[model samples]
Target: MNVVLFNPRAQKAHRRLPLSLLMLARVLDCEWALVDGNVEPGAEQRLDALCARPGTVLLVTVMPGPQLGVATPSCRRLKARYPGLTIVWGGYFATVYPEAAARDPGVDFVVLGQGERTLPELLDALRAGGDPTAVPGVAAWRDGGLVRGPTRASVRPADFPDPPYERLDMERYAARTFLGDRTYNHHASAGCPYFCNFCAVVNMFEGKWIPDPADHVVRIVRRLATEYRADAIEFHDNNFFAWEKRVVEVSRGITDLGVSWWGEARIDTMLGFSGATWEAMARSGLRMVFFGAESGDQDAIDGMEKGGLTVEDTRALNRLARRHGIRPEFSFVLANPGDPERDVERSLALVRDLKADNPDCEIILYMYTPVPLPGMYDEATKQGFALPKTIDDWLSPEWAGYDRRRNPRTPWITPGLVDSVYDFETVLHARYPTVSDLRMGPWQRRALRALSAARWRLGWMKAPYELRLLQKAWGYRRPEEMGF
Candidate 1:
């Protein structure tokens, strides 16, 4: 079968063929083409070109909010251009809102939950000229009616075919800063074990961590580095360090392979491990690690249900990472429910303290948005805040803006906090010039200020796509060069 897998972005045009699509292609043993939705300015043009070919099935993956807006128009255009062509929509957004996604005129089938097994089955059925409505995990529009099927059983990560790395545009992705020069993406584990209120990972995977065997993980990394010439590998697991023994084994295996890699770990996992384990990781080429330290305030931490991490715990972990020469990237949320001005101030102060204490470490501050997962949205509704009426409402273009705006029942700290945090970091850098400086400089600072101002004045609603582009253009600068 001729299959085209598409990754669609909402605002900015930045996209690469997702590693998932490559895996899907290998499973079907079909001719596959991966397209970035934003490569052209208009979705119609891109969709038309893809639909122009005969006997082609388009599998479009979409994330939440404006990205859905971006993908929906394209799907609609494809349906109009080639009425016989099959259109399948998958991803987190489709999983969460299968019924709504199925209702869209452009979407023929919505694959809820993991598409690894179900997608191939649906395609095979279509190839056999079988009824798509019989496919499990599929919500389909047929005969002027919608048919929703039972959710398919989850598939183990090991069950997935090794991703078809040969099919990817390796050079294009390698040019990106985050992916690094010789980057290969692999998943050692699937699903998240945690039940954080604001997290969708658990909901997406149903609170299960289907980890691949350590040997399997080792094999993939070895191939990626030795054969694919990957300079680095990224463990795409939601929580890499959830299992201590598995992580240790993986670390040892990576060391054995003599390759560099990066992944995300919860603060608890770091604190739980011995210093020697981290040292081994560092020796094995674990150059960087990301941690989601939502807040420094203990009350806020409790509210977020982030156990095993206190302000002090984070500090100690920072020290441990520094001792091992692993660059620790800390992610912080500026606002949460019931967060007052003081909480915001304390969070900022904590960021300043961390920067002061570990000048070499990287800290990222983000404004809080209530993700539309079960627990978080339930809390938001219980608190009497206006819940996002549709999936599109959750697409926050403002996230790419410099200045933040307030929403109903959201804490007062929401407005101006982005600018305030940027300013705070700027001042902190100026006050402590001796520290390893990672601040935005004059030109970049002015650019952010201008972007922020434009976003605030014009609003993200008017030009959602442009805001995404602006975000990528100005998102990352060298820490030493950028004031914050």
Candidate 2:
């Protein structure tokens, strides 16, 4: 059976290829094609082109929260055109809400958790004219009811090959950096060890961390550098520094290849490394590292069950990273459960302090968005926040995940606070534009700042989607920068 995989475009066109779809394609036994909606003119055109070909038995669409809405209409259109097409939904969104996802008429199956093994197994069954219900980690509709199955075990990273970048138009991809032209995205591991209450990663991976062999990761890096002519690499792992020794080994391996790289890590994990270890990583070309400094106040951190993390820890780590010639960037959440006004101020103060200490340091500020994860969704529900009750709810344009830039307010976050926190972040983005923001010109930068100030002053403004439109009009963003 011929299988087609679709990746709906983000709000902005992204150069980084979809790794989940790539991985799924890697293990599939039948003829398969990957259609990226992000680069295409429209999702409908892409789907129509694929469906025009005969003998296409199955269609798969991967959902990252933001693109779920974009995929809904395209799936419906394709189903109408090709009634025989078996539409399957997978990836982060389906893993969390299989039943709700299956409720959508366009979606015939929902592959929960990981899809590498599950997808191939399901396809094999379909090819044999066997019951798809026998496949684990899949939810399908049968007899007017949803049939759900247990998730399959996570696969070792070593067992899977690097993403199938050869299937994509590599030249069409570009990184966000000035040097992003030759940049590529990669992952040496899957899943996170920590269960940060607000994070859906833990729920998606069932709190299990699976890492690839260090040597194998080194080989992949070397291949990327040698074959793809990649000058830079971004390790997209959520917890790259989970094991200090493993990180050191990987860093040294990359250093030997003479390629500069960046990745994200928890602050405590970075602190856990000794001075010499960090120095080794820095010397090896670890140019930047990101930490989830979720909030500035300890109470806010505790409220999120972000264990043992403190503002002090954040300050120390940023300082140390700068000392070692590694740029430190942070992500701060302005609104959280029970965060008093003072707590928000503390977070802003920390952002200012980081910039003052090292103007080069990057700070990304975000309002607390309620996603359908256990700890976060449950708490938000208690606070009178309603979770998306069905697939249609998730596909709603106003869904919180659609656009973080626009208003996606939680019940706990008053409209005034959302405006305040967003205005604060916009100012910071103007002052210390991240290293990746090398393309924005001075005129555009000033315009963004002025726009932010105007929105903030007009506190009565209910919803502001125009700012995002303005940002695009000014050529400040890539097609993949914003979610659709």
lDDT of the candidates, in the order given: 0.67, 0.73
Scanning candidate 2 in windows of ten residues, the lowest lDDT window is: 475-484
Poorly placed runs, candidate 2 (over 4 Å): 11-13, 52-55, 142-145, 174-176, 374-376, 400-406, 442-474, 477-484
Q: What is the Å distance of residue 8 in model 2 from its true position?
A: 1.4
- Cα lDDT for residue 145, model 2? 74
Q: In candidate 1, what are the lDDT values of residues 1-484, reduced to their tens digit?
A: 7788887754332233366566567677677777764443564565567667888899988876456767877778778878888889888777766666777778878887788888878988888998776888888766656687776766777777787777665654542334355565677777887777666675577677788888888888887778767777777788988887777788888786666777888887787788778877888888778898878787777777665568788888888888888888787776666664556778877776776677767766665656556554566667665544333444445432311212323434454654565555434323323212223345654555554454343322233344344434645432322212
Which of the numbered candidates is closest to the native, going by highest TM-score? 2
lDDT, candidate 1, equals 0.67
lDDT of 2 by residue, 391-447 (tens): 787657677443353355567667677666765654555444455665578777777
Provide the TM-score for each candidate, comma-separated. Answer: 0.80, 0.89
